[model samples]
Target: MKKLTTLRTKVFAAVMLTIATVAATAQTNGSGRLVKQDRDLPGFTEIEAGSAFSIKVSQGDDIKVTVETDDNYLDKIETVVKGDRLHIASMGMKNPSAMRVYIRMPELKTLDISGAARIETDGGITGTTLEIIASGASKVKLDLNVELLNSKVSGASKAEFNGNASVHRSEISGAANLNALNLKTLTTNARVSGAGKASIFARDEITADLSGAGALSYYDNGQLNKISKPGTLTFTPQNPGSGPSEEISASVEATDAGDSTIVKIGDIKVSVREGNPTKITIGGSELEVDDNGNVNFKRKKQTRFDGHWGGFELGVNGYVNKDRQFDMPEGYEFLDLRMEKSVNVKLNFYEQNFNLISNKFGLTTGLGFEWNNYRFDNNVVLLKDGNDLINDNFLYARNYNKSKLVVNYLNLPLLLEYQTNRFSKKNSFHIGAGLQTGLRIGSHTKLVYQDDGRKKKDKDPGDYHINPFKYDLMVRVGWGKLNLHANYSLNTLFKNNRGPELYPFTIGIALVSW
Candidate 1:
């Protein structure tokens, strides 16, 4: 019986030894040098990182992770998935500058970060709810489009936010700071303590509680209720203080000066001179009332213009054939696009306007970047055969989950713009039409699929016979803050006779403007 027990013990020890050998071989090659590695992990909705590493998260259909680091430290990083949470940390190393981790999942519900780790999202995160918790002097930045956002910052951590949200609730303590003035929310509730500072934007209602030496700044004209104790509160230009905190004396006076009757009310002064004009001066600004009882704000005599070219735009991309039809005319069905998936993005970074007639009409010019994606509807890929693009379906063993072609251009536009109001941006109607020219900067094709239960992405960048230069007629129309833009190509998508004779166009609304 003793011999039998001893035999079982030896077998158990051998199994443990074999498992350790396999794990060590997987982390390094025969040379004992560590290398870059990818970990196949189960689905997780929560992430917890406790190290000083650069982490980027994005939305995807499946969970994927790629860890890039120096060969010496590859074996020291640890990624463990337990339950519905993924914990990332380093065993003993501290602040490895060569480490970068890219993580993607279908959705994310919660993120917890400690230490000095820096985390960011690749694009806007849209979901029902998102919760962010940061401590230990960490940093987090996200572009959010969510229904509800809950953020907590402590221990000198900092968080930056942009995009839009329906409601936001945040708590800051210690010396932490929350900078969310660019995140437009419908309603907000915030609490600050210790020496933390918070800046937020709200549209409808805001309720805040402040204590200690913390400060709060908000961009909203909505209803506000605050409980302030030693902390300072500030208002941004989107909404200003309605009245003075303390009551002050007021007076009115009238006088006559050289055939002009002058009336003074508070800081406003009105001057009415016969056979001239009725002018009102408030501080340094001047307003003139014409014969028709129209009050117009006098502007500088220099060339005045209202430009509508600088903004961020999003739209769908499409191409029409030679006959101006979307339907492919036989032998060209491969170029067909999935309209909903083909996207166009424009970032108008700079703009200038020169007035031609008052502020109503002006010549506008701007610099922008145009990113166009053509997602294919069929299960095929475009291959460059000489100078022409041909369709092929034999490159992959499995069907791709997503396939798309991307083109980027540096764009310059010259437009004639008109505005209905000079300075009343809230009530103005604007229209701009112009010619836009673009220089193609880059092009690529991307494919995503599953290989043996693992998600994989393949990117191939090449010219693909795309036109080097493009010209388009552009139009922009908007009322108040809502703007819509459209573009129609004046030339074929590809060089003459190189590919299908298709003209690309886009129509979308401006998501943001200045």
Candidate 2:
């Protein structure tokens, strides 16, 4: 009996040891392992996400919420269902990158995000009416097969949509970007304000209200009713024969042009040529007063259309190597630029236009001066020599606060321009494409650095292997007073075999124009 009790005690000790080891192993593994838990939540018709949590939603017969995250974070995340809305959020978690919530519901009528959370639908959202609201830097991409879609996006958020909807109503403000170009809609009512940008695909009808520096581009032929305030706005249609076919009535604003008084209403204009016997011109028809003061109606003669030039432009300059890539090739890293800081400014001070094809088309010649600043990403200075490679000619020293090369050019451009509505300056759509030739007026290198706790600036004038004369292919397109321009250099930036074969280009917006 003594041996039996001793053996039983030994067996109990071994079992207890094994159990403790297993418990410790599990605790160690659970600390770093991810845990997935499913919460049996009630059915919800709407969903809201906040606090930077990623959410994936799908449609199913029953509602289910499955959360996957670090084992310790499983309890910190919140999934609360109140009435018909399911709210998914994190309480105090600093890093929620690993947290993912998968939601399944029978129907989803609304999806709202009030934080920087990323929400995407696994499949198409099918319903009669669907509303999506996004704010606070959130990103939402959804596929919809709904009858009606109402979306309001603000802040720096972006919303992208695809699929088919009968009607889509969108209001976008701030710096938001709305890309619904693939979401085919029969009718769309859009309001874009601030610096927002929207690309939409509407088939039949579209009503657009625009303000601020916003731009709207639409695909497909849609009859438009547009209202625009006094601001820089761009309306571009992607498809041929798209945009407004009929003009809507608007308040009139009058401006004087020489001896003529031009009254503008929306995109339409009427000109009254004032003199002893006043004459009025409307749409190609003219009402004239003779010397005897007798009223007569006649067909109006073709008039001259003023070209759009003489504007102040601000843009960013970039370089593309011989491989047509923005990245510099090997041994050419010193030529890499701080592209965002490489500013390009232009002042077009003079313009001359010659009419062609009854004032609808013209040839425009303009004189402008361009100031191009190429800020180097590396701390290197350009040397003044036309005989050596850039790598062999530059000096690299201490880290400077600013290192840049400046080039000033006197530009002469010859453009063939066309206008859609020649009668109204505020309503016409104009596009110009032409060649620009430039002569280098000045070139210099500037460096700003600190020396012994004191800021010092140095400027050195140099040829720096830069091309004395350069040519570029330039294109300009705009609606009303808002215009955008791009230029691509045809020749290399530097003399052949002297520096890296870089092609310079610029893209920018016209700030002020006449």
Candidate 3:
């Protein structure tokens, strides 16, 4: 019996020892020999590269990294994390195998890429700023959601951005190309000693200073503010709607008649003496060109159609339910809606028009956000049961003076507009009739009153039986910047039979028209 007990104890000990050894192996070599090291770095803010290697970065909570390389080149890469910045570089240029580095971190404040390196992102990176300095035939590609970006390229390097950005500023020298897409604004100062090019697409505005034989191309809706010496600048306007087809081209040529230069663009021609570069004569108008190569057209009224406009509008809104179709629950009634206190606000991002014939009649469509508020005349409360909105009187409450229902929506408006003079700055009679569709974002009721001599407020957030989708018929008529607007909802305010069948209408004045 004693020998059998001793044998059992020995077997149990051996099993536990084997289990521990397997666990330790998994902790060290689970990802295989491709990953040399995996580590965590807290409070990392930026990344800087020193040499030509591939990198993939992604957004995460705490900074984490995995160094991936071939077995033969595992000892040829190094990663260092310092205060707010992480540095990745090659130990030496002797290794022929390329290294792949993967990084995960929180949103960074800056990303600096320099030297001969290839840096990419696993997904779109959001940050405040981005900087890239490439040399020695290196390449950098980024999918970014950044607010500010600055890039500088020298030697034979190239950089491209595939995501949206708010503002981008860049400088290029040597032979390279910088391509960016969906940029809101772009500013570039380029000097091409050899052969270089910069192309930007879907931009709102472009400001460039070009020198040497380099070229720049842009497709945008906004104006081009340029200072060019001897390079090519091609601009394609972003026209969404059908309009009069027009092509504009300009070129400068040296004339044999003295040291003057002749600038010919379509039917307009200007002659500039070399000694008097600022003075040019176009048609019968004498224009002054600024030192930055900006020509002002204020000397004559230049009438051109601007295809798109964006701005905001604020107005007061009031609803009318004359048919009294709104049905309340057994113990509740809707107080009179206050027309003076109700408000409507819209933020128009883009309004594009296509000319049907000339520019007098057009079709317009755009994207915007609409916020509507309807203030009730009495102190009332709202409750929601499932998808139904139920109204309850202030039975347990007292001294509430104001109660309002607010609804927010994302709206798309399609209209047919007509104007007497399409390209006039003066008063022009304009009228538009349209249909708008809205997707509900949120709905809430706000109540304000005095309780025991202290001001108090209550807010309730829910669907409130408001329709998830709404469509309305709208019309606008006015002169120039001022217009009277009206909207009538075709659908009931609530879901079928869930609440009142109120058809809402708004009459207000829009401050601006596009």
Tell me the tens digit of each residue's lDDT in model 3 across 1-514. 3463355345434433433343354433222345457755556778887576788888887778888776656666777788878888776444444477888888766666765677787888887787666664568787887777777765456788776566677776555667663443434333443335576543334555576545565544433322335553434346332211233667988867768778787557776666564665555566777667887653443244333223345555544333533333343355345545777877554455677866777787766668889887566677776755645664666556888999998877888887887656345787889898989999999988887788888998878878999899988776666666677888877778676557776555543333
- Candidate 2 overall Cα lDDT vs. reference? 0.77
Residue 275, candidate 3: alpha-carbon lDDT: 58
The most accurate candidate by TM-score is: 1
Q: How many residue pairs clash in each candidate?
A: 0, 0, 0
Worst 10 residues of 2 by lDDT: 238-247
Superior by lDDT: candidate 2 or candidate 3: 2
Model 1, runs deviating above 4 Å: 1-280, 283-303
lDDT of each: 0.77, 0.77, 0.64
Off by over 4 Å in 3: 1-268, 271-309, 322-332, 385-388, 512-514
| Stretches of model 2 off by over 4 angstroms after superposition | 1-302, 384-386, 391-396
Q: What's the CA RMSD for each of the models? A: 23.1, 24.3, 24.9
TM-score list, all predictions: 0.48, 0.43, 0.45
lDDT of 1 by residue, 266-328 (tens): 567788877767988876578999777888886433336767876667777778778776766
